[model samples]
Target: MIPIRDTAPCYSRPLATWGLIVVCVIIFVWLQFLPFEVSNPLIARFGMVPLRYSDPSWAEHVGLPFDGYLSFLTSLFLHGNWFHLIINMWFLWIFGDNIEDRMGHLSFLAFYLLCGLIATALQWYFDPRLEIPVVGASGPIAGVLAAYFFLYPLERVVLWVPPIVVHVPAIAFLGLWVIIQLYEATTSILFEGGVAKMAWWAHLGGFIAGFLLYRLFLKKPPDGIKMEDSSSFKI
Candidate 1:
């Protein structure tokens, strides 16, 4: 199911979320305009390649840096295609504002990067020798969804289920999403033998991080403001 929007409220501006979207869009567009020869190498250099860190000799043989920990954060701004970028950004747009509102700007940004780092780390843990470059914001965005799942359990999300739109409770929608990710991650590891296809493990890890760590980043709501307000702050 494709999510259209959520019914959660946000009183504060989501500047950090907007900034992240803009940065990702700009980088993606710039990569699209570059020659394939240049762009492909650039992506390989910046994208997270687990093997680069797992096998030092092989990484040096291919001229990759000695340390690639930066890619754990860089990969969040890089996407493989327009569809990949759109879906991630859309999900961020839908759920991110509320998260940012609750956490404040700087904390949200740090939380996002931390989640992305953990997501990629978990993916690397599962397939340390995989050579493919993992690039996308889905991991971090999954973290945002997790925060929304907890913060807005009583809220509803609007989804496009092909013929018509339907409103689903936040708990049900996000719970189903987590189940799908787990199923896909498990089947991919069992059948495909690795995560070279998609980083479902990263999504699961990010969701786990958000589920467990969101409270640490959250700030107190303004005086007299309750977090359960259902009136969303539109961008």
Candidate 2:
């Protein structure tokens, strides 16, 4: 299902959400302007490479500090293409504001980064030997979806059920999404050596992290306040 929007009105502006989107846009623009291969070599030097923590050749060659911890954060800002960047940012835009409203700006930012780090750690744990550079905000955005599902499960969401467009409860859409991720992860494991490059495990990892972390970080709304339906507007 393609979720168009939620019905709830955000209590706060979600400054951090906008800020993150802006930062992602700027990074995406910068990446587009540069030669694709110019950063290809650098990605190997700086991007997280699962398990094998070998010395970075580019770091040594360029006399730069190649810290793994730093890469955990930097990888979120990098993407493979315009589509990758747009979809990630779009997810953040749609679901992030409500999450930010619940956690507040600063706390939401911390929660986001924390989830991203944990998601990366999980991915690395699963495939430490792989040398492919992991990049994108999908992991963290998946966390946001997890948190959203818990905080407002009943909120109505407008979605297109391929060939049929309709509205459904947020929980229903997100729940199905999680199931799909689990199925993909299982298939990836069972059907070894597939050409599919999507990181289903990362989504699973981030979803789990978001589910657990929301309990700790989400703030209960004030009494008498009600969340709105997310699919009130027609696209």
Candidate 3:
């Protein structure tokens, strides 16, 4: 199901969320413009390769240097195609603002990166010797969705189906998503033989991480520094 939006009301301007979207868009545009041969190299250099950690010699054979944990974060900003970039940015745009609003700016930024790091690490753990580079924001976006599920259990998510739009309870929508990821992870493990495919483990890991970490970071408005009562400090 394609998510059109949510009905949740976020009172503050989610500047950090907006900033992330802009930065990701700018990077995607730059990547799109690079010469085709160079673009692949650029993606490889920056995208996370699980073997870079498990077997640096194998990673070197694939033209990747010993990245020393940097790709865990860098991979979040790289995308394989326009569809990959757009879909990820779209989900981030939809679900990220409320998360940023509740956490304030810097806290949300750190939360995002930490979630991404854990997501990549978990993917690496499942297939330590894989040489293919994984790139995209889906893992961290899954993290954001997890936070939303925890914080806004009753919020309505609007799903678009051609000319029809329907509202599903946030709990139901996110619950279903996580279930699908788990099923996919299971199938990938059981059926893929020795090949790693979608990084379903990353999605599961990020969601699980967000589930665990959000309570630590979400703004306790009653005692925390109060955010301004504004529509959106949108940039």
Candidate 4:
């Protein structure tokens, strides 16, 4: 399903969310202007490569930088193509604003990076020797989706499900997504030798991290407001 919007209202401006979107777009556009040879090498240098950490000998042989560990964080801002960038940014736009509104800007940004890091770590643990560069914002965006799922469980998500646009409870929408990601992650590990082009493990890991960690980052509710009460949510 393609998510259009959610029923949850944001009292504060999504400054951090907008800032992240702008940064990703600017980086993508700049990379597009560079030649494939140049851009590809840059991505390889900065994008998360599991093998670079799994085998230092091979990493040295391939001349991957010693500080390649930074890729865990840096790769979040990189994208392989326009579709990847657009879809990730769209997910962020859909889910991130409310998360930022709930956690406040800096806390949301920190939570995002922490989730991305944990997601990267999980992917690396599962496919330690895979020699592929994983780039894009999907991991952190998955985290955002998980946060939205918990914080607004009963909130309705407006989606275009083929011929009709319908509203579904956030749990139903995000639960389906979680199930799909779990299935894909399992299939990839068993049948694909844990080497699917898409990083399903990272997606699952990010969601898990966010699910377990979001409450810690959430801001205290004002006065009589309850944080998890969906009855007061806006449609």
Candidate 5:
């Protein structure tokens, strides 16, 4: 299902979220301008590579700079193509504003990076031996989705289910997402040699990290912002 929008309202503009999307877009545009020879090397150097750490010899082959640690952050801004960039940025656009409203701007940005780091770490943990470089904002965006899932469990979301648009409870929509991630993650580990085309574990990890970190990072809403429930949320 593709979410069109959410019913929950946001009083403050999500500046950080917008900035992130802009940065990602600019980077993608620059990437588009680069020839394949340079673009391929850029992705190799910046995208997270588990093999850089797990098998030290891998670095000799790809030459991951800054010892490959900074790739965790750089990878968040890189995307392989227009479709990959659009899907990730679209997700951030949908869920990020409400999450930004809930946590204040700077805090939300930190929360985003932390979740991305955690997502990268988890992907490495699950596929340490795999050599592919994982790239995208899906990790941080997953964090935003998890925060929204908790912040407005009952809020309705409009989604496209092929031929129809459906309004579903936030809980149902996000719950189904987590379920799909879990199923995909498990099956990937079991049958795909622990490496899927997309970083499924990173998506799952980002959600889990967001679930655990949102409360820690949460702050008072802006003067005009009002929270739903402000008391109870369901699973």
Candidate 6:
């Protein structure tokens, strides 16, 4: 199912969310200008390699001495293709504004990076020997979805079911989304090459991190609704 928009209302403008979208777009555009084929050594330099701690030759040539840790954050801004970049950024634009409003600017930014890092770590943990580069904002955006689920369970999300349509609660939609990820994750473990490209574990890890960390960073409504009780407020 594709999400069109959410019905939740925000009291504050999401400037930070727009800024993040712009940054991601610019980085993706820059990456497009570079050679992206697997044969190109440049891919290894900018991409996140799960097992290796050493810096790629391109990074060293460019005067970046750090290993893939920095790439964990940087890789989020890169994409393998137009479809990859569009889908990831689309979700980010859809859900990020509400999350930014709830967590404020700086806090949301830190939370986003932290979620991405944890998501990368989770993927690394599962596929330590895999050398394929994982890139995209889906993992961090999954984190935002988790926080949104927790903060606004009753909020309505308009979903486009191909040619059909349905309105579902954000909690239900995101819940099913996570379930799909879990199914893929488990199937991938049970059947070799069940899913070739997706990082299901990263989504799981980001969701868990967001669900937990949201408690500490979530802003209380100006009306003094308890965080736990704020779900009762409907749009």
Best candidate, TM-score-wise? 4
Off by over 4 Å in 1: 192-196, 221-235
- lDDT accuracy of residue 104 in candidate 3: 85
RMSD of 2: 4.3
Q: Candidate 4's residue-wise lDDT over 22-87, tens digit each?
A: 999999999999999999888988899999998889988998956848999999999989999999
Query: How would you encode candidate 5's per-residue C-alpha lDDT over 125-220 as one tens digit per residue?
Result: 988877778999988899999998888888888999999999998889999988988998899877854447788899999999999999888886
lDDT for each residue of candidate 1 in 1-235, tens digit (9 for 90 to 100): 7999887767999999999999999999999999999999888888999899999899889978765388888988999999999999999999999999989999999999899999999998987887878999988888888988887886889999999999989889999999999998888878864434689999999999988899889887679976543334321
For 1-235, candidate 3 gives per-residue lDDT tens digits of 7999998888889898888888888988998888989888877788887888898777777667786788899998888778888888998999999899889888898888888889999999987877778888888888899999877777788998678899988889999999999998888778867555578888998998898998778766776567542223311
Q: Give lDDT: candidate 6, residue 113.
A: 81
lDDT score, candidate 1 = 0.88
Measured on C-alpha atoms, candidate 5 has an lDDT of 0.88
Worst 10 residues of 6 by lDDT: 51-60
Q: Is candidate 4 or candidate 6 better by TM-score?
A: 4
Taking the tens digit of each residue's C-alpha lDDT, what string does model 6 give over 90-115? 88888888888878988898888888
Q: After TM-score superposition, what is the CA distance of residue 46 in candidate 6 from its true location, in Å? A: 2.3
Better of 3 and 5 by TM-score: 5
lDDT of 3: 0.84
Error of 4 at 67 (Å): 0.7
Q: lDDT of all predictions, in order shown?
A: 0.88, 0.78, 0.84, 0.89, 0.88, 0.78
Give stretches of model 5 more than 4 Å off: 65-68, 192-195, 221-235
Candidate 3: segments with Cα more than 4 A from true spot: 194-197, 223-235
Top-down lDDT ranking:
4, 1, 5, 3, 6, 2
lDDT of 2 by residue, 79-195 (tens): 888888888887898899999988888889888888888887777776665667788887888899999987778787788688987978788889999999898878877887864
Give, for candidate 1, the lowest lDDT window spanning 10 residues: 226-235
Instruction: Candidate 3: give the clashing pairs.
Output: 13-232, 13-233
Q: For this target, which candidate reaches the highest lDDT against the unseen true structure?
A: 4
What is the alpha-carbon lDDT for the whole of candidate 2?
A: 0.78
